[model samples]
Target chain A: MAALALPILALGALTACGAEEETGTPASDTTRTLKVGYISGTSLGPAFVADALGCYRDEGLTIEFEPIKNPADAIAFLATDKLDAYVGSPSAGMFNQVAKGAELKMVASLGSVNTPEGEAAPSGLFGAKSIKSVEELKGKRVALLGSVGSATSYLLGKSLEAGGLSFGDVELVTLGSSDMVPALKNGGVEAALLFAPETQKAIDQDVAHALVDSKKAYGSSTTAGIIFGTKLLKTERATGVSFLKANACAAKRFEGDWRKDAEIVKMLADFMKVPENTISGGGLYAFDSSLAINEGTLTEMQEMFVKVEGILTYTDLLPADKLVDDTLRAEAVGAA
Target chain B: MSPVTRDQEAVESTGTWRTIAPGPAELDPRGYARRRTLMERGLAILVPVALISLWQLLAGAGVLESNYFPPPSDIAASWADLLASGVYQESVLASLSRIVSGYLLGTSCAVALGMVIGSVRLLRVALEPTISALYTVPKLAILPLLLLIFGLGETSKILLVALTCFFVVLINTIDAVSSVSPRYHDVGRSCGASRWSTLVHITLPAALPQTLTGMRIASGLAVIVIVGAEFVAADAGLGFLVWNSWNLGVPEHMYVGIVSISLIGVIVGLVLRGVEWLLTPWNR
Candidate 1:
């Protein structure tokens, strides 16, 4: 029995090793699964919309929306086997990852601030009662989230520059944007970059007030969008194209007067686990109508990453065209 | 001391000395007074070199992906670049300062409280169960709460480290004290030694080995808690460097951070071991 057990155990180990991620066509080919990691915040509205409206199902693609606590985590897993796609900004973090040869491809536009059709950018510079505007942040501590090479810092920095103050002017504190509300309340940080429900939560709690919206300085920006890992983009692009089509449909439905729709409001409220009334009110993120990944905005983002953050040298800059593939978006739009 | 006495002392060594081993391979070779053999030294260097060479080989052969797992050469280059920039030194200094301060405070408080608890039946009965229960709770769970209480500055990081260290030291110290044997106490009483004298001379000496082991454990915990806390919220630390590097897809820089943390653990462990050698010479 002991001699016989070795081969059996080896077979079992081989089977376990073979049980990797889903690849090739499934036995049931009708429903192709795309594991998309996204934050629960409003920035990832289109994915939520697609999941709710059954757009993914309609296109024969099952988008498993892995609601990541922080979208920043998805960036790390974007190139690996863990995640297929993620909704996040074109920050230095993402750019550097691509430069490092993480097989991540920018596929679709989630939305940006420029064409804030029905959605308005939910994130803004919030601060305690003492600070009122960007100018007041000079010499005061300001908490920024999304890591060191974050676009939020650039947004804040640009705004500060307009007021004759640079990044060095303020004492920068690093903390999660979600935790910033309570931090502001208890005076952990003087100012913070908060988004969506957390911002509303702070405002309702009467501890923090909106100081400056980044859109004013950065202008209508393509904050984040859908990105594909090397595996799906290389082997299963048909599924990738289908996933983008679903996003486009979701974006169109969301752009077509979603604020007034009680169903969408309730869906978003339940999805976000916030008060139903919070969805009905303002402070919702405006997604782009076309769901188009703009090359210019990405270049602008890369430039800021290089000049503002010094994350990458000018020589290391991978052009926006190389980073993004417009063919998938073009196909998705045509199919939609 | 006489040569005879010296030989006897060497025979009954505490093992603190890294004396050369007598084996078939090294029996013929001349041994250093108290040093590892060339064979040992060669093996020591060989393992890591072989592993790293294999890593580089796999990477060059396309078996190991350089995207996630970088080559040692790349890691070395990044490590050198970072150190040359001076930020590495500043971050290491900041983290080390926090770790030392927190470990000292936590261990000191634990030793005091543990001694009292072990000495008094009432204190032990009242507090021991509660402490043991609290020790099982994950220290990371209280990080956000610590932030709320202590704010997002260095205070929260220090407090979290101290909190984690407190449990390990307290539990070990209590166990060490309780296990020192009641016979020692009885002997002290017969000798007409005062309670303080009994504790200081007899019980404390008996418990020193266990307590030092606790300190060593607490030292490692301090490194872990500080790194984790820094990863959650820190602008300057090896953890921050690793995290930011990982996010930015710089494998070389990430590996540098990885190496730095391992180096911290090694240095801290060696320091604790050296302290133990001083405090508990016989046990060594």
Candidate 2:
């Protein structure tokens, strides 16, 4: 009886292992659907436009958009193998996921904002209106749209230090950009660092003012929006690159003639549930058609991320070249 | 005469052979007590020890991916961190206070309304169908509507708990009160007792056990619903803790929160059982 049972158990184990291995491998079929999860924040506009334009379908890829409540949830879903890609705020939280052996790689760059002359985008100590000047914001509450360890939060901390304000002097509050407007209006916070449309809303509402644009603060030609993933990039590189190319096209179209792209603007307005005039007047940031991830900007971002958030401890920071893969992006842009 | 005597003798011998055999010494009072004590002590230690050992072994072997399933050690560390930081305590206390307030209010209202409806056939006929229909619908399906109305504050969370608990207690109270025998009421009437007196002395005691059982069920349901209520738009609470950990992609912390919830459930179950035992000693 024991001898008979041993063989049976072994057979069962073998079958289970074989089954898992077979299913675990990525499907070889090029026509496989890619399910992308994204937060319904303004960051998702380009991706939505790309989807709307049938870019993914044109490349023989089926795209499905799953709305996540927050960036953290989006990242979690991506890490758990529930999503092929997640588009949300660039955060050190993503770094935490990467540290856990998830094979995620930043793929393509997206939208970036330019600062209006004489005013910086609202962010840290320098951005606080209560300070009257950068010197007065020496010890005040500053809010970031994400967590303490997030990318924006770290960048804000660096920006404050550069402007002669130490991070220790300012208290950091983690709040969403949508919540930040009301929070600032209520004086629950002194200033909040946020990205566009929300930043524009803040300025329009007169609840808060822009401190400094990220590009101005960093004083570098940084890529604000970038696509990141691994499995999808590897298996569906052409489709992924085409998706970015479509977004670039949309961006160019939006920048070239805002009036002509009224439909796109209207769609964005409907999704945001704000007035069309408000959206149009928001001075929305646009991305360039270049699919390349600027090496210089990434280096600065990595350094800032490490110094402030300790996202990658000194030993964990990989070489800059390995952080980005632009071959597919190049191919797609070349075809265009 | 000789054949009759032989048959009688065989019958007598068979009757003697069929006498009861002696039982084991442990069946006696002293031995039995000792055996029971030993069994109780063994049970007291064995289950927890076995569970902990298994958990530790599985965790150490990386059987369930530490980030996702976290080992006992990691959970313990997190628990310690929470306790030391005072965040866990504060959230637990806040949630407990809300749950208790909602539960008490719900139970009191349910009992009063149930008694009134159960006593009056007209009211019962009018209300039972509506209440039953409402009960058939899932309690969670109305959460969005509640949030819209209440704006994701304490009132909404408490209301959800109350809503779920109220129906359970109401249904149970109705069943308990209505199940009273007609004979008891008849006897009370024959004794020239007042309606109130009859209800207080005879009907109430008979229904108390079932009513208490209902309260017990409602209490457990309150805990479950309260957790769900806290999940959405909550800044603090065990449910919020689970949600936060899930969002942060710390699956182990999520599991820890879940396990803590189960512990709370078990504790609540034990309390309910104790209450049942106290109210219905006859069940013992």
- Please name the candidate that would achieve the greatest TM-score relative to the true structure: 1
Q: What's the fnat for candidate 2, on a 0 to 1 scale? A: 0.19
lDDT of 2 by residue, B76-159 (tens): 787776778786787687678777888888888998888888877899899999999987777777876775566445787788
Find the candidate with the highest lDDT and give its number.
Answer: 1
TM-score for each prediction?
0.84, 0.67
Taking the tens digit of each residue's C-alpha lDDT, what string does model 1 give over A138-166?
A: 88888887654665666666566556776
Q: Which segments of model 2 are wrong by more than 4 Å?
A: A1-33, A51-54, A57-64, A67-70, A91-93, A109-227, A232-243, A256-259, A262-285, A291-336, B1-65, B133-153
Model 2 lDDT, full chain set: 0.65
Residue lDDT tens for model 1, B124-173: 88998899999988887898888888777788888888888888999888
In Å, residue A53's CA in model 1 sits off its true spot by 2.5
Model number 2 iRMSD: 5.1
Residue-level lDDT for A49 in candidate 2: 67
